[model samples]
Target: MKIFSENITVPASAIDENSHVNNITYLKWCIDVAEKHWLSTAPKQFQESHFWVVLEHTISYKNPSFEGEELRVETWVTLAEGVKSERSYKITRISDNKVLVNAKTVWCYVELESQRPARITEEIRALFL
Candidate 1:
């Protein structure tokens, strides 16, 4: 699978009372990167037929990130099963290469109109794999 990586700069607004990036913000970063990765691989028809929904997420915070620090967020598909898939993320201090956070999320394919589970296509699977 292809892992998508993007650089992010910590902004003053992202800081919390403790003067570090908020824990929830890290999860948002993970979600954003995962969406970007999906868009890159999915076709326009896929967007019209279905949407992916997060079923579960597990996040681990290993270190703190401060404002003005440069970070890299990476995401990839770890597994694809029947109508569900697992995505993994890593946030790291770019210069030092220290992983600040890691997350794994389970997502389900859903038919947009019915809002029910739907099977994924081989074309979609190939794009992700």
Candidate 2:
């Protein structure tokens, strides 16, 4: 599968009282990256006909990240079958190259009008490849 990644500088506002990146901030980044990855390659017609909704999220915190640190956030689709896709995420500090967070999210494709689950087509799976 194709891997999408970008570097982000940790903002002061993203740090919580614990003096590190907040849990919610990390979660938000994971979702945002996944959305970007999907939209970057998925055709407009397919997007109009279907949308994805998160069914589950599993995140692990391995290390703490501080404000002003540059982090590498990476995401990729691990599997896309049936009506669901499993995506994985990894966040690491650029300085020490330490893994900060690892996460996986399961998203279900649903029809636009009826909001019912839709089967994954070969074309849709090839979009990421």
Per-residue lDDT of model 2, residues 1-129, tens digit only? 689998999999999999999999999999998888878888999888999999999999999999999999999989999999999999999999999999999999999999899998999988764
State the weakest 10-residue window (summed lDDT) of model 1.
120-129
lDDT of 1 by residue, 3-107 (tens): 898999999988999999999999999999988887877988888889989999999999999999999999988888899999999999998999999999999
Worst window of 10 by summed lDDT in candidate 2: 120-129
TM-score of each: 0.96, 0.96
Clash list (residue pairs), candidate 2:
none
Residue 10's lDDT in candidate 1: 93
After superposition, which runs of candidate 1 have C-alpha atoms over 4 Å from their true positions? none
lDDT scores in order: 0.92, 0.92
**126 in model 1: Cα distance from truth in Å?**
1.0
